[model samples]
Target: MNKRLLAIIAAIGATTIYGINHTVAKGIMPHYVQPYGFIILRVLGAAILFWLISPLGPKEKIDPKDYLRMIVCAFLGMGLNMLVFFKGLSLSTPINSAVLITTTPIIVLVLSAVILKEKISSRKILGIGIGLFGALGLILYGSEVRQDAPNIPMGNFLIFLNSIFYGSYLVVVKALITKYHPFTFMKWLFSLGVLICLPFGLEEFMQIEWSSLPFEAYRGIAFVILGTTFCTYLFNIFALTQLKASTLSAFVYVQPLVGIGYAIFTGQDNLTLIKIVAACFVLVGVYLASRKPNRFYQKLK
Candidate 1:
């Protein structure tokens, strides 16, 4: 199999986990475990897993300067990304969260141009505008008050911030992705993740009443720790080795479809005409943004 094909699969797999995660992780929050506390569990569990498997990858030493970049990556990707996302998800519906996250690719495209000096064609810019419009429409107009979602507006804002943090992380981590094995990179990023998340999450982490929680709650927690955090991050880093950050982030377009499907299948959410239209906009925008140039154009360039 081609490495780039495998990377696409990896990126798809990561988004699939994330799609399910909107509901799976939400199933455990506030009632069973608070969001910040859940962040601690995810970071700690993934960090441990990364370290345990680190020996399987080729041994490599990090350049001293790269450690700083790694820390920033950890802070953005693992710490703030997980922190704000979970907190926001807890206060928002699964469908809304799913739809808004598609903003990541646009953010990634912009950041890549600014930081990496990557060129953006006019088509991509138009796609970004259309996608942003759809996302913002959903954020502003799609409001359904649920018992679970306490503050949809604030939650949506935080989720948007989470996308920004995650988009920035993609660009930052791209610098280091090819320099080390996935295990080596993940181990250190997650290790620093534990430290960066500790202060904000510790008090909430201490508040959990462990023994009294139900099996479903435990299942949710386990899914987050193992399926969402560990596997998704691992898959994404591997994909990064073969795909550009913009390409990888473009897979976020799949999240809402998968997320809404899972949400509907599980009776957690309902579909609306607005949502369907927004999903179309997002899908088309992603296609336009991620499309490759013709062979002639490629050769000319």
Candidate 2:
């Protein structure tokens, strides 16, 4: 019941939903909805949900100076991040999306060092090299010609770019979370996200024939909008209040385990030798990059 434990649980819950989303969201796109159109539903749905509950949190107004930072966070965290990721998922395998997203912790580590002035160790630097090597290998050579995945390489690349945007958002939003309630921050963040992303998604959003879609499609869409977008972001924001950005981001290591397992279980994706090997490199790299410095080293210093 302590804050740290709750934060850990929240981070785990968010990552688990995201892991499953690799398959669930992908199932809804290009057929039930295009990638951009799906993002519109996600942002718009989450915005409404957040606004509905905004009154439960303490009443507080954001400082005018913070508006720019909030807008930037909205764009990075929700707008381009979600847009690029869902597009990539539509064009790539669930396992690939899962593995590629593991790079987020590494990106967060680097960003934290640069933006937050967190110290970086040689071990973490080496881990970065190894992780990027695996990610790049997957992007360059993990291509497969499948009915579902049209362009694997490009999709993987976009997913990688999404990690950068998402990682940056985590670091940037750390300051804002301290100043405002999670509900307040999230409602406005998602509201701005609706405005930022609506233009790109409106045409596709309108094309959907809601009544014609099957039940499975509806389930997938609901899971994405409610579980993936609304819940994950809310959980992560609450987690951030009690944990460091780097610490919270490190929990992304859990994604591939849940994602790959669920994907295989549901027959949505299968693991290749290359995928297995690349995943090893990423997991090892993440372990190195995310581990805390030894107390002995600190004492020696």
Candidate 3:
């Protein structure tokens, strides 16, 4: 198959893993393990996996000048991105996390325009406005009292912050992905992540009562480390090699559909009228923001 098709599949695979992770990862937090501690496990585990497989990829040395960019990418993509996300998930509903994550396309669009010097058409600007409005609405008003979710507004805000970090990472990593093998880029990226996150998570990581944890919690942790962190990053990095950052980020549109459906099916979260409406706004905004201007105008013609 063509590289484009393979990239699409990789992006979709990553999105699917992330969608399910909303619930699966959340199931292990604050009780079995706190959010920051879980991040340590994720980064450390993925770092080890990446290192183990790094030998198979082409041996290419990174330019010394690119070291700073790699460190920034690690902080944005793995450290702060995962840290805030899991913390947000621990304090927010699954559906809320799912819906909020769909805004990544919009965030990527804005970041691309600013950092990558990509053009933003009128439609995209309007989409950004509408998308931010929907996201802000959800953050301000989408509260529900639940045992699992302690601070819904704060959680939603943190999740939004994660979108920015993650979106920025996508745009910034594009250049590095072009220069280095995904294995090479990711191994170092995650190694840096371990150091960045270690200070915050070490105390909590030590507090875990591993012997007392149930089987399901162990399964959840394993899935998070193996599937969510390792596989998803690999898939996304591969996808980035063949797709634009915006195009790869656009695949986040599938996340809420998969995440919400799984959450509802598993009895982890439910939808409300406000959530439904906010989701509509965010999805429409994402569609507009990610649509190519030439293609959109061609359809009009």
Evaluated at residue 7, the lDDT of candidate 3 is: 90
- Model 1 segments beyond 4 Å from truth? 1-12, 235-251, 293-301
- Over 106-188, each residue of candidate 1 has an lDDT whose tens digit, in order, gives 77777777776778889988987787777777777666768998887778878888989998887778668767887888888
Which tens-of-lDDT digit does each residue in 1-301 have in candidate 3? 9999999999999999989999998788888999999999999999999999999998888899999999999999999988999999999988899999888777877876776577788998998888888899899999998999999999999999999999888777777866788789888998999999999999999999999999999999999999998888778768877887657656768899999999999999999988998898888887887776333221111
| lDDT against the true structure, each candidate | 0.82, 0.86, 0.86
Q: Which ten residues in a row have the lowest lDDT in candidate 1?
A: 292-301
lDDT of 2 by residue, 217-264 (tens): 999989988998888877986887788765775676889999999999
Superposing every Cα of model 3 onto the true structure, what RMSD results?
4.0
Q: Give the TM-scores of the predictions, in the order they appear.
A: 0.88, 0.90, 0.90
User: Once superposed on the true structure, which residue ranges of model 2 sit more than 4 Å away at CA?
Assistant: 1-11, 236-250, 293-301
Q: CA shift at 294, candidate 2, in angstroms?
A: 12
